[model samples]
Target chain A: MIVSNMSKDELMKDIMAHDFKLYDLQLYLNTHPSDENALCMYQNLVNDTDELKDEYEEKYGPLTACSAAGDCEWKWIKNPWPWDKGGN
Target chain B: MWEYEKKLQYPINIKKPDPQMAKFIISQYGGPDGELAASLRYLSQKFSMPTEITKATLNDIGTEELAHLEMVGTLVSQLTKGVSPEEIKAAGLGDYYTDHGISVYPQSAAGNPFTAAYIQVKGDPRTDLYEDMAAEQKARSTYEYLIDLADDPDVIDVLKYLRQREVVHFQRFGEALRTVEEKLADKKFYMNNMINQPNKDCGCNKPKTKDCGCNKQ
Candidate 1:
């Protein structure tokens, strides 16, 4: 789902979607811990999140954290910052 | 769906290099405590972060460090390009040359490898975030020192940009830490101690030794 074929914009959209959904579920579950519909929705969102995460990682380096596989020369330690793109 | 902020994501243009300043400037690339370490330090800690705010801040700051790392790299790369092997050796880049043979890596301007000791993965939000905050200040101070040594206008411009970023990051982390504190406020254990205790069962008791269970006062 997160393959390089997807544009950076699309991948970013998917990431934001998952983040918001994760937060929504967290907030809902905090009060309605037994809502089966919410739980199921949360599970589905989580699975989507994972798949997208994998895709994004394979294509545009990593967005969240490090990879232990050693593909990156500095694998465990590195990233492109918000302003890492250089200049203003 | 999340709307992306395009303004926050763009490439930086480090101006052209000056050979005379290149040698000394490259030192920040791999000196004992340099930008490379700072980037690696924050980026590495995100793996074990406990809170979303902490994770997000780490992600943002870590990303910024990578940019700074590039600025350092770009500075070194541009500086060393035109100089011949003889020139490099004479310029004291001989040590730098022996390690990478002119390849600009993030290891060090001196060519020493990166180490994990530069950062801590304490696994507690409070401790890790506080370390991150301190790290930003230290990095900003380092940038200030670099600015003091630098004579090139382009180099100074880049350094100033980086220094301002450190301040921004410090502020964001402060906000994140407050969020964490707010979450912990309801818990009696958190209310009693300013820092979170490492031993969850230790009940926020202040430790007697240097390795206190809590990270902050």
Candidate 2:
């Protein structure tokens, strides 16, 4: 679980780092499909990314359209964009 | 079929506006061998790819090109953000300014607007992969030229990063081409239209055969 007091920028940086790792791994796995070690590492990253995304959405609102939920009003449009200071 | 990520793949924090630099950088945004062409080429080519690995490789790399396109756009925007009208005209951006008024438009350094004619979506996987490999090198060269023209460390750093990506993409495309060649029939190695030929019944595998597959109608 992420620290509750982390700034939006800090949290987003962490999430983006994880997402980059996932994308890199995905490209590698596409070529080396039979590599068992890479497959296991890929699985672990997937699980970690899911957790990070969930934590991010809970604190900073949904990163994607599908993740928007809960009793709060529509939050997808509420947050600042990634280029904006708070959004990053 | 694709989702947008709001942030740049790499950060761009240019502190000064230099319209001259923006002019050269715009080439990568919409030039003949630019990121937009790269993305469209791979994405359009993936549909007819013969193997699953090649198809997925094209898709992944194509998607990354889209992100790169955004990065280049951001660089252009930042570099031209606060230039005065006189500065813009002095920088030889007067023609671009007259059209778009400091907005980022997909055009080469020479002011040619991006066109689909710049890319090919050949159904032949090997041919298309070879084209992709060449496109990466072209882009890398363009980046090198831009880096040479740019004095700003911030801009140079990003340009170097992008150039390195082109090298990596070229390597991957080369691997994909090899993968494709390994899958082709031994005798049909250099035959044109190997993937699209309807009747592959020619017994070219037998060295003593008088009528090779090539002689067939």
Candidate 3:
């Protein structure tokens, strides 16, 4: 669950933490596909991360190029690129 | 087949602008054992992989390496931001600055431009997997060296995270290599290779099934 008061950096850290866990588990499951415990954790992270990503994109601007930009203009391009200082 | 993510996989906020450090770290961006080579090596190898598991593993790892490449680029970009020409000269990045003034370019610290010759993509799965394993080790060592040279605590933290990732990737790649070996030894998998058109599915693994997964596609 995301705290409404959290800063963009904090929310991003939360998302990155979830994604790192998910990515590691994905790599593990690539070889150990039958591991039920890992699979369960992976599924849980998938749901959590998706929710987190939606929240992030909704508030902080589009993470992906095709993400929603309220209104007719292009905000994705306006959002700070990753290389911008503290942009992430 | 690829979608662009505007944000970094990991956040990097390097407070200090150290052109010297940027020069050294740019090596990982485009050097011989850099992330670019790592991503290209595995992605290029995916089509030739012998099994589904091997193919997926390579593809995922390759994609992740692209993220790592972004991290390296960010590190370099952040480090070089606002650096003065005098500082650049002092950092021995003079030659680099002459060509690409404050922009991140894919070249080594010693001035060698990135080349495809940096990576190997043998058609043989075992041979290519071995090369991947070695590549991971080389990358891990490069991170270690970079960490050792880094004075900024912020920079070191990111480097450490990236280093640990290299370790995890090494473990995963090693596991993938074993998975490929086991599949190669399985009679069912061996038989599936004689497939009909890929679209035919052929149900090639059944005991009653034979001569499937061929070049008819």
Candidate 4:
């Protein structure tokens, strides 16, 4: 999970950037079939992104207005807002 | 994975509804070439995409389109608020409400509902990406027309937002095309006119004929 706090806009911008990068990587891999470097890079990005997401949730209120206490009847309502990095 | 705050995603403050414009705009909500189709079309095709980059692009673009769809739904909902059966009938919305019951649906404003034909799932990346490019252009033109037809500021604002996304999607699709081309071997890229050749359906082994069995153009 991300430990540092990033501004909402800054974090969203990062999310968009990463989204584009990941999408590009995914498309490239489809035709190229295999590229270990791309895979590794993709993996690293994914891992780092999870940390960023955690940081975002902790700093802001739940991305969604719902509770995230994990013992809820409907967990989906706990989903973070789209602007939240988690949406990315 | 991306991190963002929810409050910022929809920053534009939309005022109360204008019923007149709402009627026409709802067509886009359910229209053949409207936001619902765009969202479902792109989102459905993402799974069949061959590359990670393409899939990711599809996901992002598809997701964005979904947001656009929601915006259209929101507009429709707001427009219909406090509407009585008589007012709805007066606005020619009774039929719409009868079927959809004030619920947002994926049908065309003409009353034609959502069809799988809206999306193409060709296994061939080239064909699918090109279709995506065309779809963006079609949506862009529709927005332009909608803007031309409507004069309300709120409607215009929303239309403008949707229009900008079309341009962005077009750019992304172009990039996606180049990305696909760059992956091709030099010999395969130039020697064979593979792009023109009939693209086989990636979803199923059956060779794709003239049409990709998607929605009519």
Candidate 5:
């Protein structure tokens, strides 16, 4: 039920936020593996990142090389790479 | 076995190019104590970890280091982007440019290519975890040096974030080492050999399996 009309930058920003949350939770879980609350939160964030990534890639391009699928002509090379102005 | 995340762990928006800064920062991308080595080290070490907690710790931290590697590469690439040939030569990136153009290559600022020799996968949970902790500190110091050299707020901001992660990683590795030590004590085991044989079929090698009943001599 997600809309696909978001600009590339907006989509990228959303993905970045979710990814950062997952990274933070991952490190926390590394030390506090027994925390049920953190485990639950981590699961939710992982789901969010999955959805955001799917939506972004479908509309714009693959975020990672492996995500490039279905008749795409080497799309990984086509980018404002993460270091590029639009890539970040 | 890793999935690629599209976005950076941090958002890096460098508005200016500074090749001089890029020269030193490239070290973090591929230097001896760089993120690349950190990532490779932990990922490689995870396979032989004696406990589930330590294994997961190494895997997760190793993965995070990959993200950090991307961030550092981003910083170096952005900083080196669009500079004049004269600027490149003046910034002392001329040698790098001769080899890599503006693209990011896995090499230290001193022009040493990244080598697996930079990391140790000793296969002992305690030893590897201790090494991981030390690696994080070395990376943190490198970041501190980069932060001092950087003049741009945006670049410094990202560098600070990366440096802070090293501190957090160090703490986590310390905790993992403690967990391994406690497990060793509970089993009345001492790691006497430098060569770790975590996969010995003998039940003594397994930490979680209680009552394997192989008494250490």
Candidate 6:
């Protein structure tokens, strides 16, 4: 996870924040499909979230099973599982 | 159809292990109003939903409930991790340890096994949405009760997060319900909506009103 100047915890905080924002916006859009500003924000946030995930995967390995390249090692089967201490 | 994201929706790094607290916390994993029930309830109810909004809301919220389930499972696992048998007996988990050991089995804090009968899957759209809303509120209340019993700041913090999500989900379900009701009253339900479709061909789940001659067709 040492792909950038930010520590793993700090980077994870950013990623979680982004994911939460996207999820909240998605719920809002479900009820208010015609909202103009929310629509625009949703599109931009999707791209931003994707970029963050790519950065995370590149550094710490894949964030998902689909993203696993397995070039060197099987990253999907790696440690933490998002539950253990220091997990994600 | 869902992908496993290798990180939590929110981070949980509980340092202290409290088996006594874990015993009660397991309720959220398998109790009547547990995350497992909530996820299965919403996901099952989405299929017969009349509107796109309700379906998406149910589907997404159900998926989020799965994350909550994982969080609760983690809480239970970490809280009981490496505890001695003597500690388990003292914490009143002796029966559970004898049955399931350290594994995160889906059972109530009271030791009742998880059952599908805990949730309802009425195909009626409005009925299903209302059930989803009630489920969220009940989950929120359960979290509050857990908070009252928990002294660990680490455990309380994660419980607070889960409780807050329940409140948010209730609001969303309410909104979705309002949208669906408005559409139903407007008499412009989805063309794909099974009940009283535009062509009057699909009439499943329709009430026996004069307007709904589903049986006549």
Best-fitting candidate, scored by DockQ:
6
For residues B65-145, could you state the per-residue lDDT of candidate 6 as single tens digits? Answer: 999999999999889888999999999999999998887989888999999999999999888888888888999999999
Model 4 per-residue lDDT tens digits across residues A13-86: 56545654665565555444577899899888887766665665566445443434444444445444342223
Q: lDDT tens string, model 5, B1-217? A: 9876556778888889999998899899999999999999999999999887788889999989998999998888888778998999998888888988878999888999999999999878888888999999999999999888888999989999899999989988898899888877785666645337655555544565556465545
After best superposition, candidate 4 residue B117: deviation in angstroms? 1.5
What TM-score, computed on C-alpha atoms, does each candidate reach? Answer: 0.54, 0.83, 0.88, 0.62, 0.81, 0.87
Looking at candidate 6, what TM-score does chain B attain? 0.86
- Every model: Cα RMSD to truth: 14.2, 7.5, 7.5, 13.4, 7.9, 8.0
lDDT of 2 at B114: 100
Q: Give the DockQ of candidate 3.
A: 0.73
Considering just the first chain, candidate 5 attains a TM-score of 0.89
Segments of candidate 1 deviating more than 4 angstroms: A1-88, B1-16, B27-33, B109-111, B187-217
Q: On residues B1-217, what C-alpha lDDT tens digit does candidate 4 reach at each position?
A: 4333343323333455455566677667767678777777777778787767788777777766665676777666666666677777777778876776666666665677777677677878888889889988988888888898777676688788778778877877787778778787445533534435557434444455768667466
Better of 2 and 4 by TM-score: 2
lDDT of 1 by residue, B140-167 (tens): 8877877887787767876786687778
- Compose the digit string of candidate 3's lDDT tens values, residues A1-88: 5636667899888888998899888888987889999999999999988888888877788877677557786787784788798787
**Candidate 4 positional error at B184, Å:** 3.0
In order, the TM-score of chain B in each prediction is: 0.71, 0.85, 0.85, 0.76, 0.85, 0.86
| Winner by TM-score between candidate 5 and candidate 4 | 5
DockQ for candidate 1: 0.08
- Name the runs in model 3 displaced over 4 angstroms: A1-3, B185-217
Question: What is the model-wide C-alpha lDDT for candidate 3?
Answer: 0.88
- Tell me the tens digit of each residue's lDDT in model 5 across A1-88: 3666778888888888787777777777877889999999999888877887888888788888886765847787776767566676
User: In model 1, which residue pairs have backbone atoms overlapping below 3 Å?
Assistant: A81-B63, A81-B64, A85-B10, A85-B11, A85-B12, A86-B11, A86-B12, A87-B12, B30-B108, B30-B109
Summarize candidate 2's per-residue lDDT along B1-217 as a digit string, tens digits: 9876555677667887889999999999999999999999999999999888899999999999998898898888888877899999999999999999979899999999999999998899999999999999999999999988999998998899899889988888888888999888456546555345546745433356666566677
Ranking by TM-score: 3, 6, 2, 5, 4, 1
